[model samples]
Target: MIDTRWWQRGIFYQVYPRSFQDTDGDGIGDLDGIRRRLDYLAGLGVDAIWVSPIYPSPMADFGYDVADYCGIHPMFGDLEAFDRLVADVHARGLKLVLDFVPNHTSDQHLWFRESRASRDNPKRDWYIWRDPAPDGGPPNNWISNFGGPAWTLDAASGQYYYHAFLKEQPDLNWRNPEVRAAMHDVLRFWMARGVDGFRVDVIWHLMKDADFRDNPPNPGYRPEEGDIGRFLQTHSADQPEVHDIIAELRRVVDEFPDRVLIGEIYLPIDRLVAYYGEDLAGAHLPFNFQLIYASWNAESLAALIEEYEGSLPRGGWPNWVLGNHDRPRIASRVGHDRARAAAVLLLTLRGTPTMYYGDEIGMENVPISPEDVHDPWEKNEPGLGLGRDPERTPMQWDASPNAGFTAGRPWLPVAANFAHCNVAAMLDDPFSILALYRRLIALRRVHPALQTGSYRPVTAHGDVLAYQRELGGESLFVVLNLGGETQRGIALPDGVAEGHVLLSTRLDREEKVTSGFSLRAHEGLVIALSAAT
Candidate 1:
């Protein structure tokens, strides 16, 4: 058995705080609201909660833009409220991880305020600033993730400053030793105040090449919205310098025993593993995003799983996430009919799985009208279906009165379909998605094979996905029917024992029931085997 701490093996639920719950009825979710919902998470069987940023900000990029690293946003609560939240969550045996935005800071941050004061300000080197082009434009043609030129020319200082994201969130120049020390100190301050670790924000963007050369255009034709998707390469951004900084950050985390450090890396598999470092002196879990890419095909998923398992660093743990505040939720991605099977795939995987808020109830993306759209992405890429507001809507707790999330209006409107999809309604229905989630979590606890097992793929074809998870001297095989009708006689590897149906959610039975098994639409099973039996 793995004797690791709870942080190593426990399931984490990511909460987009602004949309989770609202206690004060000010159209915004707050820490107090999350405090009231602690029992619900405890019941859901999650070990920790990773709350999105709640620091003071102008709300340009929601809470991702931080005006103050140390102060709580008054909209969320005060220091006492935050303290109460920590105490309450710990009382529930749950750890809390705050979002750490080390890559950049809100343009209004005090350091930025002082740095932008004059050309020769003492803190001027804290942020990336450069002279304008000969034509007196931005430093280069490089674009922000949001849109337009990454460098914004500041008339006051007669220089162009860098921002990989929104202009309001300026990139910090990590080349300055003082800036690196300050970011590290910000992390230490949170650790002192009882934060478990950090979900390091935009970790790769913390460092950039000194030469402000223009990024080459894509060879393939594309709309100007997403990245240069012509090739899969992420050449300019994922620099090797990131490893040294991660080494330093890991040292800080080691100071506090059992503290967790998860990096939000959007790089490919090979590049992602480097965050763990050769000596394993890096982040605890580089967040896995394969589930997002392989949402449609079982064959692709099986191949990706094999590749990911083979790519892990020794002594390093694996983490899987199906959805987050940034991306569209899984239910929405895979369509409603396939989400249940996706749930089985998620819970039975051998790594720690993270459930995005509201996913348990199978929440669909709430479509946004142009008039009500708040995300800058949609604003920049209108009609491109690129806005994030759909997935960031308020949580649905009940059927009436703003879905029992807020007494007042919500920051983003809940889906009209919440009348059927909600906690109160699902709590009574055994077959509801929320109940299924609860059962899956409980089953994981009941069988150690589901948690600490080694995954081996079961060979199958055409809409039938099968795999075995083996550990603790036992193996549990799982199969899912992705098609609408029943599927029969799928195949497993050699040494297959006659299988007894452990659990099946299908409404159909196979005719032959050969070395493989049969499953109806969305039906999934966990069957175990032992050499002694």
Candidate 2:
């Protein structure tokens, strides 16, 4: 048997620090607040915690524009507070993964500041800087992910610097050997501080075309798709050279034993899988986000899973994500009932699963008014509905003022449904979404078939999707009804006559099942199948 690492078999919970818990009553969460919640996370059965950026920043992109890679932001905490948090997390036996934004740096960063100070500055080559086009416009036709041109004109230096996201985030020049060495040292600095892993931010955007070619216009782009989709991004992102850079990053991570490298690549599955590098020397997991964007019907999801599984390179591991800080909550995307069913799908999948901060309680996207909007994406491109503030609201912890996320007002407004849709409220209700997630995770813990077994598709028809996980003769069958109509006499694989119900999304009806069983609307089940007889 192959030796499985801790990341391979463990569940990862993403903690968005600013909205998780606030200790100083400043309407923002901090490191000590996360330390206080370690017990809660341990009780939730997650084996790892992946915290979003808490690094020193100008808040231009809300931590994505990192000003200092090695220091913690004062708003979050100092190095001492971070050390204490790391200690507490390790004490609870949970691995800590930090977000590593290698693609860009805050314009205020010393490197960028010097690079923009003058054309002759020593660090002028640290970031991508190019002369203006013949027409004195942007250097190329590349579009920023946030909005507008990807290049920002620096009047002082008489050059334009490139940024994939916000203008305040200047893209690093990975082609420079010094820049690559400096970034690798950043990883070593954190690994020495005991960070178990890194979820590399936009790993695909690390390198760009050397000639700075203009990307082709996206003919199929629609107005609702927002400004970033206007171009095909053929030259600006997903360059072939990125794999070599990733392999180098992988070497840095491999220096520290048992540390995993997860890449954030938003390309198609075929392109996304390439991040694994030759012989799986790239990212350990490239963050499978198909569930977040795929249609929620059984047929589409079934095909997606099969395609994703088949697309993996030899020995490459798979992972799944349902929601995250940048996407809508599962409950809001698929409705509350189907969200419960989705939880079962996530935990029972063949690889590591990442649960967003408030997803366990079936949190929906909160409405963010213009006055309360904090996300730069929304502020920069108003009324296009591209803002992520709705999905990045404070965690609903209790029924108290501010939902117990903070004593002061939250940075983003708490969801109005938090009064009844909180951890405290759902913990007592066995049928609640929180309870369903807990049961699913607990079921994964005791069943190796559910944790590291092979995934075989049984059938996906109408509203019912069925599959089986088997390892060492232990077979666990999962059936999910993705619609509002009840499914009757769902077909099972040949010779599978009866099985005992191990868990259900509705938290009801446990008994031996045979050929004829009625599945409730928006329900899912995990069954321990009997031997073929």
Candidate 3:
């Protein structure tokens, strides 16, 4: 029998702190706001809440740029507020995971300030710094994820510093022993504070090529893909040495019981699986984001899922992410109807599923006007539609002004459809997407087949994707229609003559299936299969 940890058998909900709620009337979500919503989160049926960063910073990249790794940002809350939120979350039997950003820090950080203060500063090696090229240009051709060169020349120091993102956020030198020790202490500090786990940001970028070689240009790069894609990033990220660093970090997390370390990696399936490390010693859950980028069709998704599952290392667990703060919402990527079907696919997959806040209500991306844009990526590289502000808009809780996310003006504009697409509005409607999510989650919790069962692909035709999850004699069948046209006469897997509908995306179906069933356009169904004779 396989030992299933809480994170492995449970659903994770990502809460974007700046947008989840606002309690101080500051137009920004704070720790207190999250505390006030603990009951709502517990009722949502998620086993864990993975909140985005709330560390002190200058908002260079929102909360991703950390100035103080051990403290909470005043904008979000103080130590008291964070401690209270953690306690409240635990009291409700829910785990809380914080975003751990060890790769970079805000330029305003004391460490960075001390490093750049002078060449003789003890902390000069804390961040990645190098002498400028002979031409007084950047050290190399590496490009920042935001845009342009990754290196920024500091006049006072007469040396270039590397930043994988904006200039305001400088990448840390993980190669330095002191840097590693300090970062490990940061993890210890949080773990001591009762943090259940950490979702490490940009985990793959922790180690860079020691040679500082220039990355080769991509011949297939397209103008529409933005400047960051101009190169293949061969040297800037995903170094083999990263696995060792991850293993070290894993040791720190292991010191605490039942703690998890989820790495945010966006590599190909082959490279992504390597983060699990030999003998499964790396991150507990290197987040699988292929679902977010894969083509949203049955054939494409089927192939992608099969490849991902096959690529996992022995004893390595898998997880799925449909949307995140950095990506477009599901409803916007796929239409609202298809988003419902996608939700079923996400929860029913043979791995842990992470639900982004507001996705339960089918929140679509809101348009961000030029004046309203706050994302540094959009400001640095405009017209590529790479801005994340659209997806990070304030959550919609009700029909009240500003969608009840705040009494004051929201930090970002609320979605235009918030009045109709909100938690409160959907709570009253049994057929709402919110209701469907609740039922699906409830079903997943009660069924062992949906938790740690073996996955087998069922023979599916055309736009229908079919699969089975079975643990012992208990079995569940999942079928989804990924197309816009209704499918009829779909074949069922062998040994499964009929099943009772447990839940449907439409939230209007509950009957026994004895023959080929018809699925509505953009629909999904979870069925409890009868015992095989």
Top candidate on lDDT is 2
lDDT of each: 0.82, 0.93, 0.92
lDDT of 3 by residue, 191-218 (tens): 9999999999999999999999999999
Greater-TM-score candidate between 1 and 2: 2
1-533 in candidate 1: lDDT tens per residue? Answer: 65766766688899998899998989999999999899999999988999999999998998888999998999999888999999999898999999999888899999899989998999999998999999998876677787666788889879988888888999888888898888788888888888898999878777776676666666774674464343322333666787888888888887887798889999889888888876888888888889987846667777888889889988777878888888898888987668877888888887889889999999989988778999987886677677899999999999988999999988888899888899989998887888778878887887788888777888547777788888777777888887788877765446764555555553223232336565766788767653433
Q: Distance from true position, residue 274, model 2, in Å? A: 0.4
- Which tens-of-lDDT digit does each residue in 24-85 have in candidate 2? 99999999999989998999999999999999999998899999999999999999998998
The list of candidate 1 runs beyond 4 A from truth reads: 224-236, 491-493, 505-516
- Candidate 1 residue pairs that clash: none
TM-score of each: 0.95, 0.99, 0.99
lDDT-wise, the better of 2 and 3 is 2
Number of clashing residue pairs in every model?
Answer: 0, 0, 0
Q: What would the TM-score be for candidate 2 when compared with the true structure? A: 0.99
Q: How far off is residue 353 in model 3, in Å?
A: 0.5
